[model samples]
Target: MPDFSPTELAVPGFVALVLIEMIWARRRNPRAYEPKDTLTSLAFGLGSTVSGLLFGGAFLALFLWAWQFRLFDVPWSWWAFALCFVLDDLAYYWVHRFGHRVRWFWASHVNHHSSQHYNLSTALRQTWTGFLTLGFAFKLPLVLIGFHPGMIAICAGFNLIYQFWIHTEAIGRMPRWFEAVMNTPSHHRVHHATNPRYLDRNYAGVFIVWDRMFGTFEAEVDNEKIRYGIVKQLGSFNLLWAVFHEWIGIVQDMWRAPWGSKLGYLLREPGWTHDGSRETSDMIRQRWQERQGEQTKSVSTENPIAGEAEPA
Candidate 1:
């Protein structure tokens, strides 16, 4: 193991600055992050930084050693970095998709969905154990293909930075071409939404085109407003609870459910409501509005089902 200088310190600094600005800007409108939200975000953000960097560093070492050992006839070029970006993102899509579909991965990822507001601070509310689970598999190809360890770290960091700005609600849809090709605020908000239509939809990181290409793309519908947070709602803001709470709930749900339903709840799509409940969030919300006899505001105009996970 080589001495680590905590070079990734800048990642957290960048995150903090963005969070501060989000606070400053939202102060007037008062949609700024709530105190509990801030505390939870900080806990996960710091926890993830420590875990991701340490795990990433260890993998970085292995990547370096593999290159030095001449495991493959490696090629270096600007195009290689470009390829790395694509491959890295492709790997991310699967990992992210799995996170929503698998009860265990959801344990790690649920903290992110714990946030109700989609802002830069929301991006920092990441999972502490995600890197330990699905994130590393995506990087393995780079090592095997002989991309240098330093380059891999650089590309990973660069991808992280590129994704930061996509967290904002300030930016609307970019030009049609840009939105079609890349992930933007609009697309990411759809990813964060829990509205039945927006559940488990967009999973792309830097490129929205992947979702478009792969049939996961959902356009933002103007009439429907965005509501963030996971289904079943996280009632607490404690970081530890936020991280493990879903896993605990899944266990409890499984224990209480019949054996078959228990497996179905964890393995099947998240929207498969327990106890054969027919009404989804969409139905409940619409009925509530109807009962009130208010003019119906469109659910989010964004594609409803934007980020729904694949069934088990």
Candidate 2:
């Protein structure tokens, strides 16, 4: 069976949602939809689609090649479809988590987070260089295990489609039960936040269960407003610069480093350095934790009775 792209089919719906969100934002706050930022996001989305058209076949062919070595003929049933969806989501979770943790992957992934505004268009800001990053390697195991390549493709397509709507600030938290089980706009807002506490949290593609189980889940704090975009904001609105700037930075970083440390610049976490100069998400989170601890201690010192509770 030929693989159908669900994302391609969802293009009209995507455009409609963007339009709706723009109207909604204008009424709520005109500042939410900046003309340049929205256009830049749409351009990146276009680039990603074009790149996929050019390079998608190569990756699909690779998956089919690997499909020849089947461990079992997992038949397509309702149950199999359900299993594939769950497993594919699990694959996506790790792929996404590593996209932040590993610089090589982040080079392609960074553009998605380049926009400072969190709206429907921000979800469309996708990567054009994903094939170069070999992020698809994560899905090969599903094919080798006998879930047909087409099934995997369908699951992945639906996964991408599902994630589209969660990229907005327009929606608030869902019912508590839904929020707990599934990825909501609120949870994804935290994921895109560059705040120290929000860094690298909520990597779920469809299900929030993976994040909660893996200890990556963070509730969207009411106190700390989400500041979207990367730690260092892109200085230009040039589409080419937005797309390839991180890839260029990797080359520049590697050029000055010693041979032994060159791989670290590429493979280590995004903020890692040969010397202890920069901070990774882990380091940032640790520092934030220490600051919170100190604040708690200071409060206790200032009011011992407030810190103390009488035994019942």
Candidate 2 all-Cα RMSD: 1.1
lDDT of 1: 0.72
Stretches of candidate 2 off by over 4 Å are none
Clashing pairs in 2: none
lDDT digits (tens) for residues 56-138 of candidate 1: 66766666666665456545578987887788788778778777776667777777888887777777787777754545666
Best-fitting candidate, scored by lDDT: 2
What is the Cα root-mean-square deviation between model 1 and the actual structure? Answer: 8.0
Over 1-312, each residue of candidate 2 has an lDDT whose tens digit, in order, gives 764778889999999999999889988968778899999999999999899989988988888999999899999899999999999999999999999999999999999999999999999899999989999999999999999988998999999999999998889889999999999999999999999999999999999999999999999998887899998899789999999999999999999899999999999999998997888889988999999999999999999987898899
- The TM-score values for the models, in the order shown, are 0.77, 0.97
Candidate that scores best on TM-score: 2
TM-score of 2: 0.97
TM-score of 1: 0.77
